[model samples]
Target chain A: MNPLRIAPTDETPTVNFIPDEGKFEISGNSYPENSTKFYSPVLDWLRRFCAEAKNQKITLDFNFDYFNTSSAKYILEILRILQDCQKNGNECLVRWHYLEEDTDMQEAGEDYRDSIDLNFEFVVREDTL
Target chain B: MTDKQLLYAYNGEMSNPVLNKILSTIQTKLSALGEKRNVVKNVNTILIECCQNLIYHAKDKDTLKEDFFPSVSIYKDAGGYRISTRNVVAGEDAQKLEAYLAKLNAFSPEELKNFYKERLTDGKISAKGGGGLGLLNMIRASKDGKLVYRFDPVNEQYLMFTLSFLM
Candidate 1:
């Protein structure tokens, strides 16, 4: 399958899903004009990736500076997809990165961690991204 | 009078690009004023939800009179940053929003957090795809988990809904 690469926009995040390297990274801001329109294709790509990359070690990295409520829903959706894949024997780990002083982002990471059954590692960055 | 500074204000049609410009401008302004990084992030997060809520839920701008164009303003005073928005909404929409806000305002922070997670994981996304998380997020991000709002009857068919947040 082809790698899924979406350039970051002022309203959306950078999506870099590399199957060969078993690394999936989504970073930057994500308050798209239309959350569904922006995330549907990305969700589709992830479904396909999970189906094809079974029994593999996957690392998902999420580094978001800001995301709106709508984008928050999509983030949970993305995590649910990963959780399902993990249930199917894929070794999945999530690295949630937030700015050091951003308690909201840190709590957001904690929210996702509490709601999902995946191994989560929180990393704090010293400077703004 | 308290020392109050007006940071940004907009009134008119709202689009994605317009929202981006407003957020970027406010982000820079807040940071330049010596706000901590966390404060800036929280302010921007609340502003995003507020502006997008206006953009997505307000009735079509082309159909509304100029006086009814959605408006948002950010202000800073001794307490903290404050954001307020006003937009014309259908009467039925106003009722639904009022009830939702009342329910949310009644929740403690812990209860609100649990409700947010439950809705996020289980609630169906709205046709517009936000899944009704806008007000909940605003309440969560507000300084004291409170939202002040009112719906003044614009006419029999519509209402001028106003919401304010302090962070």
Candidate 2:
């Protein structure tokens, strides 16, 4: 399958989910004018990918500098999908990279981790956003 | 002053640079007025939510090839900023909104945090729209100060929501 790559906009994150490599990353701001319109296709693609995800070691990296409530809602959707994937016998390592200075972003990552019953790691990046 | 007299109006497309500049201006002015850091962040987040609300939910119409926009206001009080938005809303929409805001107004900070976590974990609520957090953020921002809210009926197709957040 072709790699799924979405370009980031002022109000949407860049989504890079490569099934071949078992790596995923979502970064940037996501306060899209209409979040449902922005996130639906991505969610559908993710659903399609996860349905076929087999025996694969998956690593998801989330480095969201800023995401609006709607975007945050979609992130939870992604996390839920990952949780289901993990339940299906796939070893998934979820990594959330946040800017050291942004206490809000760090807290957000932790909040998501807390909600899911999965082994997720939070890493603070210095000087580079 | 009557609410109508106090409203400030801007109608046009919103650019990121313009929004950022306006937000900075609000922040700077509030800071000069002695707003604390926590207060500033809260007010800023609510303001952002309000602006996004204007951009997203406002009824759009193409008349003469221009998109009509919602009228939004930002006012300075002794304690903080207040935001009011005017738009045409259906009765059902208004009723739905009032319930959410009422629930938000009722929650304590600890409860709001728990509510946010529970909502996140459920993942079922997101389908309704992520916009629910707009009210929650307003509540979180104004934990110490009550959100003064009023919804007024206009000439049938319009409802004006005047909401305040004391930072």
Candidate 3:
């Protein structure tokens, strides 16, 4: 399958899902007017990728500066899909990035980590990006 | 008089474009204030969630009643920034929101975190795809982990809902 690359907007995130490399990254702010509409296709792509790439190792990175609650729900949905992939015998690792001083984002990462059973790493950087 | 300065306020339509404009304007204002990066980010996140609640849940969009105007205001207090939003909601929604806020306010910080995780795992997403996380996010981002709210009845069918968050 082809990689899914979406440019970032003022109210959305940049999505780069590389099937060949088995690396996926979503970064930037995400608070789309209609989050479900914006995230449906991305979720569909993940579903397809997980189904087709059996036994492949997947690394997913979520680096968000800020995202609203609706975006948070969709993000959980995406992580759950990846968790299922891991449960299906594929290797999956998730790296959640946040600013070093932004404890809210860090706590958000911890929340997701607590909710989802996967190999999750919390990466903190100084820069907001 | 209080030292709180009203940095920005908007009273008009709560459409997507208007919300975006409000967000950018507030972002610029926060940048000019020279606050810490984390402070600015927290204020921005809280402001976005507050305005979005108005956009998605405010009633009488088509009628555009004068009394039903959705409004948002940001004030810089000695402690920090205070963001507030007022919008008209259906009577039922007002009641539901009041109960939810009461329950949320009752939780301690640790309990709130635990509740947030529980909701994330079990909460049902509405038809509009809102999994009822906005209020929780606001509380989580607030300095006191509390949201000050008021509900005033406008009429039999509508109520004015006000929410304030200090960041």
Docking class of 2: acceptable
Which candidate's DockQ is highest? 1
Indicate the worst ten consecutive residues by lDDT in candidate 3 chain A: A120-129
Q: For all candidates, what are the clash counts?
A: 0, 0, 0
Model 2 scores a C-alpha lDDT of 0.69
- Scored by lDDT, model 1 comes in at 0.88
Off by over 4 Å in 1: none
By lDDT, who's the top model here?
1
Model 3 CA lDDT for position A110: 84
Interface RMSD of each: 1.3, 3.4, 1.6
TM-score of 1: 0.96
Give the per-residue lDDT of model 2 (tens digit) for B1-167.
Answer: 22322323455555445455556776686677686654555555566776766555555453212323455567665544566655445557778877877877787778888987776555453333454566666566563735667777753654555566654
Q: Scored by CA lDDT, what does every candidate get?
A: 0.88, 0.69, 0.85
On residues A1-129, what C-alpha lDDT tens digit does candidate 3 reach at each position? 999999998888999999988899999989886888889999999999988888889999999988988888889999999999988889999999988898889988888888889899988877723
Worst 10 residues of 2 chain A by lDDT: A120-129
Whichever of 2 and 3 has more TM-score, that candidate is 3
True contacts kept of each: 0.66, 0.32, 0.54
| Candidate 2 vs. true structure, TM-score | 0.77
Each prediction's RMSD to truth: 1.5, 5.0, 1.8
lDDT of 3 by residue, B32-114 (tens): 88877787788878877887877778665554677789999999988788889998888877778899999999999999888
DockQ, per model, reads 0.73, 0.28, 0.65
